[model samples]
Target: MTDWWLWLYVASMAGGTMLFLAWWARPCGVPAIEYQVAVAVPVWSGLWYAVLALGDGRVTDPGGQSVSWARYADWTVSASLLLVALALTATHALPRRHPWLPTTLVGLNVTMIAAGLLADLSAGSRSRYLYFALGTVALLGIFAVIWGPLRSVARRQPDGLHHAYVEAAALLTLLWIGYPLIWLAGPSGAGLLGPTTDTALFVLLSIASKIGWGAFDLARLRGLARRHELALAGRP
Candidate 1:
């Protein structure tokens, strides 16, 4: 309801629109399905935040602790898309192995994060700690998937794509690491931080994780395509 909240929402909407447009306007070079999913993730995330901002702001638990259902929803969709993108990238970059790993991990990650959010929304203080502990475990699992299988696949990629994948994954990991900290400082946890601070952090994290990562992915894919074309043409 404050000016900063309004501004943050507007920024989110704008960032989403720009990313979508960039995706739409660009010529397709990468695998269409994967590229589109990567591009769409951030756009959807931006819209979700925008709606959350324009709507009830933050819904509070029975104890008057604030929670953002919209954020949870956004994470559910966007985070899954992120994993899917990683999966697709891994499949493209490396020798095929088990195809089910990425999808399975995506499902688990979403469920875990969703449960944590639900626990955070409970009216009792015990649920708050439960949410924190649950979320920490979920994050560890997510990191394992990224660092283990995902990293192994990326290492097999060509140098450009390998570097891009590593950079994108690192960026995502860094940005996501802040979520529990933000939760701790937010109303759902210790109430050490204000709504404005929460909104600002979420907005920045959303843009970076979604749009920034999408850009890296698209660029990497395009670079891969160019290399393939050059190889076919018998050029460098």
Candidate 2:
């Protein structure tokens, strides 16, 4: 995690963010939030990685593990934004987004992230496992909502939009599973892996989940907009 590993991630993410903005011709009729998220996720994660690269935002826990709690901070904000972006896409076909589902999704996301953070912070204690369990429960709830209720919304979408929603949602959920598995394997939980390896995995995952994922979603949305298949915000 020390050397060019994280710095390269920062360069890719930050550079990509700038390049995406520079020659960016956002397709017409796409929601502005699409562009906003396309930029925000990478920049935010890169900033925190920059912080880690600069040797800040980290503390050695009692177990002698260097904990970059800033990664948790990064996840909290960026994952929330990602959830909103996905939620918008999920409900894009609906005439009006019910306030409850989006709000619940966000709440569950925050809870899940917060629980992971707490689990990491409470390392060397039994409660860390409890926190992990709670986070797992929250994760299950998220799955139920997205696959059950949100999938229902997807059914109402045009074919293109439905496929986009499925792609984004399924990838997101699958990618998310890697984090906890790594956490359990890395220095934080079972110590099967070292900190450097842990950090490297997180960096790669962030790149894929944020930068790569955003590109796919936005590209799909852009194509849908071009085809006049994307549902606008207010119109029934």
Candidate 3:
């Protein structure tokens, strides 16, 4: 059944991507490229989670002739992530540090994308080091956003709601990282404790991130509206 779960994961990811892209493309007015990339991040993230599911286990023959179902899933996921990253970069999302504090996030995640792809390629290597390194890079990328980018942004602008939004994004980023770890631990029958702890952490992180960032988004919007109203009244 890992194979079955793989298919399920793929289906859900694909379906979600299609739906989201369709919705994103529907609006006639041109949206900011970074915003578009931000919206698409979840889809790419979901696809990666599916790959993690596939890579968690193996099905092989007695002669050691490997059937590479996991590799195929990994390739698909890697290709998708690269494409999305490229799209984001092309749309000017990659170098977002301009005019604002230099966002190191794009640079960091680009490294992550590279490391993940390299690890996927070296899956046949005798050393599990490649896997460990890729995971490390990915995790580091997330933490950097939380610690470096979020902290700096919050400090520069102590606006509480703005801080909240950044925190939320950071939390979501962690969840995106955690989902795979949870699956790997659980499906491998490593024990309930490991998987449960990982899942719980991810879920909590996700919840906190959303709540904080959502409030920030709302607060910002409200501030904008109030300012606009004041300007309009002054003009009259």
Candidate 4:
């Protein structure tokens, strides 16, 4: 399609690559990997929507009636992705450590995708609420399980999957929290989230997401030793 669409597709594919590579390299068993991918696939799938929506360059259609297929596809992908992401996060947080969190996340993610798809056919405010509610659920999950119990474990887990999860969660939360504030002051703040604004937000969110990934990976690489520990332990 257009350069912008191509750009979004390429960028989204890059994100997908990062996600898959990280998942593949995670220090977990086959079952865990499968479980992880179940959720991970959809999250990346949502990013697929990002590519499409960015390519189409409009949230609603020409009539401003409702989310177009292109736009709906974007939402579907996002809903699916977020669903899986949440599932994996919750599974990883299981009190019994049963590996159920990942499976649960996948289940929920699937349900969300289904709901989002069906919502595409709905009329009126119902559609809006579907999207809003999905977002709210994801936000809640992020706060409750990811930031709460998972954070401590994530920070301390050996320099791999665990660490990445923690860092990514923090980065995502921070960016999500900050993005709205930026939009409020930006030109697209007049109750209209334009393509430019969406692009800007997506760029920032992507940067934040990657920063989280990199920081954790770096921490793992460096053994995550603090300054004092490095000094006490002496230079390597």
TM-score of each: 0.85, 0.90, 0.45, 0.50
All-Cα superposition RMSD per candidate:
2.7, 3.9, 8.0, 7.1
Q: What are the per-residue Cα lDDT tens digits for candidate 4 across 123-185?
A: 545564565467446545545655665555444544455654665566556655654344333
Better candidate number, 3 or 4, judged by TM-score: 4
Query: Rank by TM-score, descending?
Result: 2, 1, 4, 3
**Which ranges in model 4 have alpha carbons more than 4 Å from their true place?**
1-97, 106-122, 149-166, 176-190, 210-235
Error of 1 at 206 (Å): 1.0
**Which candidate should be chosen as best, given TM-score against the real structure?**
2
Q: Tell me, by lDDT, which candidate is best.
A: 2
lDDT of 2 at 19: 53
Ranking by lDDT: 2, 1, 4, 3
Query: What lDDT score is found at residue 61 in candidate 2?
Result: 68
C-alpha-based local distance difference test score of model 4 = 0.46
lDDT of each: 0.73, 0.80, 0.43, 0.46
lDDT of residue 135 for candidate 1: 71
Clash pairs of candidate 4?
42-81, 43-81, 46-77, 87-105, 91-101, 91-102
Model 1 lDDT tens row, 1-236: 44466456557556655765666576446767765786678667767766765765467788776677877888888888887787776666565735676777787778767776777678778876876687788788888988887778777877777777776778778888887888778767788878777777766666677777767767677777788889888999
Q: Which ten residues in a row have the lowest lDDT in candidate 3?
A: 86-95
Which residue ranges in model 1 land beyond 4 Å of their true spot? 1-21, 94-97, 234-236
